[model samples]
Target: MKKILTILMIVIMSTALFACTTQSNNEIKQDLVVGLEAAYAPFNWTVTSISDYSYPISNQPGSHVDGYDVQMSKELARIMDRNLTIKAIEWDGLIPALNSGEIDVIIAGMSPTSERKLQINFSDEYYRSEIVMVVKRNSVYENATRLIDFSGSKVVAQRGTLYDDLIDQIDNVVHQTPLDAYSNLVAAVTTNVSDAFVAELPVAESVVKSNPSLAIVKLEQGYGFESEESDITVSVGMRKSDTDLLNEINSALSQISVEVRNQMMTEAVLRNNESELTLFGLITKYLSLFVQGVGVTLLLAITGTFGGFIFSLVLVFGKTQKIDKKRDNIFKKIIKRISNGLSTAYIVLFRGTPMIVQAMIFYYGVKLITDISWWTPLSAGLIIVILNTSAYIAEILRGSMNAIDKGQMEAARSLGFSRIKSLLYIVYPQAIKNALPAIGNEFIVNLKDTAVLSVIGVLDLFNATRQVVGATYDTVTPFIITALIYLFLTGVTSIAVNYLENHKAGKELKDA
Candidate 1:
């Protein structure tokens, strides 16, 4: 009970931290991997493919990723004469990677909150954004100029963000549930799950632009929670230990004029209109969103894979022990049935549905069952992972069970043993011998699957990489390191599983 409550509390607190940010998978590797959520248009967003839109990137290699951060990172790479590599990670995970010595810089649009300062260091503020409200033009909130106007109005912010906290300050403002993706928060407002979304000005403008039916109301600077240019000022994230690198970046940033920075911001906002344009325009426009979404993409694969193994366990029965038939029947028919069925149910659901849909269902769907609020994302994520994994592992079990040979079960049955007793004593032990290799593979997949939890906001490794991008503004170093760490973990798990399989198989052969 204590453990469950603690887990529940952690999950609830996590929701309070969601935020609106840019993301993209639209770009994976530049010379420098600048991580950012590119979904925010004007700043970043995913569009189709394009040519003739070269600013700083030499490689648009096909069409998946490009954006404002890409353009800026490319320019920064140009200034420094370094190759650019873009790694897209989630909004929250970026920083822990930076502090842990994974990424070299965070270029994603991020606020240098005082809390973040304790983990790693930041660069000089690069750009400043404002706070605003986004709502349905027909909603009562359409005329809301200050947060105070929304007393008792339903409000929702991106979970795990500063805005989520900011939205909580309004008197009786009725803070509604948070969402998985910051980009999706607008949908909540448009759908009336929330009256309006509190966000940075760039986000509001881009959202309002992409969606004309929406209202973008800027509250009087003091009336709404407005951070100063210093507060909204975003910076490059770097390690304090690398004073030399920090010095170099600050020098580079100082050289760029405010006018150029403003123009960059403006171009980012303008690019948000790409969806209505020609194919080329669309490509040039949302390339950034594509790039930033990489974190979530990688996350999906990693979590799906790891989640498969955590829930499956090998069970064995022994025939030589002269076990009682009644007890064996209870184990197989009752306990085993329930446990196996549960594991099976999870797998069928996860494998049956798309992971993205699962992620959405996790964040939004589960809320109807509880008011604890925080369990919404965490439970949804684990359940999806658990389910996805069970499907693959169940097949592994069935195959291994078949490999044990029917003769063993019959041999045990011939000796006064009941059907359940015979199978437990005869068939199960050997099945474990056969299934070892497949189960190991599942673990490797699960290790990677840990990344998927980032979507609903578990700050696992990939998400850590994303936060790094936001904090540092530099990109190439973080992703390479992040990938290497994942590789090392998978490699280690593979070896351990192999050793166990070899040990158990050798024992099995000796007994035979």
Candidate 2:
């Protein structure tokens, strides 16, 4: 057991070391690190083909990203005499990534809204697009020419975006909670979760073309969203401190006329449309990625759950320690009190907070304090899972220990065993038998929750599916594949737990 644990630890540490050893912000002065949501079509999207206009996404092997933003970034890199490196970041995480020095700029069709301007600087607009509504093909809003025509309809948009804010413009519209991705928005509209969703013209066109059941409603000029220049114009985002770099980027963008920008968008749309594949074709083509993602997801789940169980054992033991008032010394008493307090506090802190927030704090916070290459996304994710899972397992263990008959400990003590020995040899084994089911359930939960780690770029099952969606523009089938994989994992775990419980019961009957 000790040897096995040591090997696991070594494997985890080695993976962390390799994952974190990427080029830091300061080391990439000659390289332009551009961040964008590669899932968005026309503006940016992931592709497997390596073409003259495509660049490989950082850290994603065998995957390349090609879109209008990518082409523009390439031209900007050429003009600035720097190599362009693209990173496919989630939309909500793009600004934070730039601010945290993870990427040099955001070219993901982001606008220079006032809210975003306060955190980072922006270059001149590269692409201008009008807002449009995407609705069901035969829905009432499909033929509506103005925003007021859909006054009572339920509308939604991607969260933290200018489009989300624009949803309230309709006089009596039902504004649904914003989702995180355009693919999600597409799902919402197609499933009738919302009557319509706000989108840019090109984005709406891309989605509508792929999904024949969907259609676009182009509002008349005066009836559209009332907006400012910042809302409609997409620009490159940079850190506020990089004024010189920002100025150079703006100069490069200025040299490219509006006609050239339009030509690039046209080319990107043509390419994106040409590469579109059927849902079944996409699943079959990307089966290898899905399999790889399963391996990663299982690795994280097993290591995290096992590590948490080990740590929680120590914590439960510490919290359940008995202090003898007459026999224990002052130092012993002090240590006991401190350990109990710390155990309780740790349990509360981790269990009370969300895992996603913890992931962000660890990933970006460590980067701010230290430039250590060993703090990779996988390592951070594992740490979060261990810490978070430890708290729940501690509570579960405590309950299981309490449920064990007190007479068992007393009986063992009378048989020439010390209290510690009684607890470890006699009490712990039964407690573990009772707790095994809960531990297995925790493993299942970890399998699903690890999907949240994709925000920090851990390529688990969900992230792999997102990459497929980005490449194929088919949202439904990739997600269906991911769901089926999760179901299989949890189902297997459940069956294993049940088998162990039944086997243990049968052995106890034989002993009796």
Candidate 3:
């Protein structure tokens, strides 16, 4: 056991040393890092194939991003004489990523509204598009000609955008909760969860073209949304401190004529709508992505479960240590009290909070405090799962410890074993055996709950499926594949854990 612990310690120390050494080199790389939500069509989306127009996303192997934004980014990179690097960040995370220096600019068709200007600076408009409402072809709002025509109807839009704010323009509008992605809005409208959703003219055209059941309500003159000019124009976002880089990007944009930009956008729409394959074809085309996603999911679950088990043991010992009030030194008593208080707080805090909330806080919070390039989404995810699982495992271990007979401790003491040795070798081992089933359940739970890590862009199973949905615009098939993969993983794990339980039981019977 001591030899194994020594090896583990050495590996951890080496990894930390390597990370610190490589961070500086990564920071100094002169690539132009551009962040975007690849789920948006025409503007940006993921593709399996690489071409002159498609750029590979950083750290996500075999996944290429393509769209007008990607082409524009490539042009800007060429103009600035730098290699372009694209990151498929979630919409809500793009600004945070840019601010944290994870990405140098945001080219995600983001509008530079007054509210957003306070946080980050924007370049001159790269794309100007009119706002339109997308509705079901058979819905009552399909024939509507103006904003007020859909009054008292259930409307929705993508959250944290100008479109979401525009839903209130209709008097007595039943505005629904804004979703996170355009695909989600598509689903909402298609499923009748919402009457209509606000979208830019190009996006509406692209969506309507692909989804025959959908239609766009393009209001005539004097019937559209009344908004500021900035709300209708998309721009590249950068840090307020990056005035020099922003000016260079604007200069590059100035060189591209409006006619050329429109041509690029038209080409994007055509390319985006070209994939008319059936659902099965999409699954077959992207099968490798699902396979990779499963591998990452399993890695997170296995590492988090075993790592958490080890840490839970430490927490259990800390929280359960008993200081002799009469004979122990004052120093020992104080140390024991502090350790117990800390252990209790850790378990309570982690257990009480949701894992998704914890993941966001840890991922962004760590980036906020220390801008370490080595701390990727996977690392942050592992830390979150381990911390969360340890809390539950600690409680399980505590109950298991209480179930053990008190005489076992006395027997070890009688045999001249120290309290630490008794707990480590005899008592704790028995407690772990008793808690094995609960620990196994925690592992299975981790396998499923790792889906939440997608919010922080971990590229786990759920995120992979979302990538497929973004590419194909078919939500049902990809999710079905994801569910089956999860079911297979959990089922196999259940069998393995049951085998271990039975083996332990047989070993105990033989000993008795």
Q: What TM value does model 1 have? A: 0.56
Give all TM-scores, in the order shown: 0.56, 0.89, 0.91
lDDT of 2: 0.86
lDDT of 3 by residue, 1-512 (tens): 99999999999999999998899666765789899888788898878777878988885767788898999999889887777888878788888777877789999999999989999999999999999999999888888998789889999998999999988889999989998777788888989999999999888877877678889999877988899999999999999999999889999999999999999999998888844557677678888888878988999999999999999989998999799989799999999999999999999999999998898788878887898878888888998999999999999999999999999998998999998999998899999999998999999999999988887777888888887777666666778888888999999999998999999999989999
Order by TM-score, highest first: 3, 2, 1
Which whole-number lDDT from 0 to 100 does residue 285 have in model 2? 74
Q: Which stretches of candidate 1 lie over 4 Å from their true place?
A: 1-31, 52-64, 100-102, 226-229, 275-407, 410-512
**Per-residue accuracy of model 2 over 1-512 as CA lDDT, tens digit each:** 99999999999999887766654533555989999887788888877657898888775555678899999999889888787888877777788778888889999999899999999999999999988899999988889998899999999998898898988889998999998888888888889999999989888877877788899899999989999988989999999999999899988988899999999998888787734566677767777778767887998999999999989988898888778799799998999999899999999999998999988888888877776767767788888899999999999989999998899987897888987798789888888889999999999999999999889877788888887776555678888888988999999999999999999999999999
**Predicted candidate 1 versus true structure: per-residue lDDT over 3-43, tens digit per residue:** 99999998877665432111222233234445555444455
Best by lDDT: 3
Task: Score candidate 3 by lDDT.
Answer: 0.88
Task: In angstroms, give how far residue 131 of model 1 lies from its true place.
Answer: 0.9
Q: Return the TM-score for candidate 2, rounded to 2 decimals.
A: 0.89
**Which candidate, 2 or 3, would have the higher lDDT against the true structure?**
3
For candidate 1, give the lDDT: 0.60
Local distance difference test scores for all models: 0.60, 0.86, 0.88
Pull out the clashing pairs in model 2: none
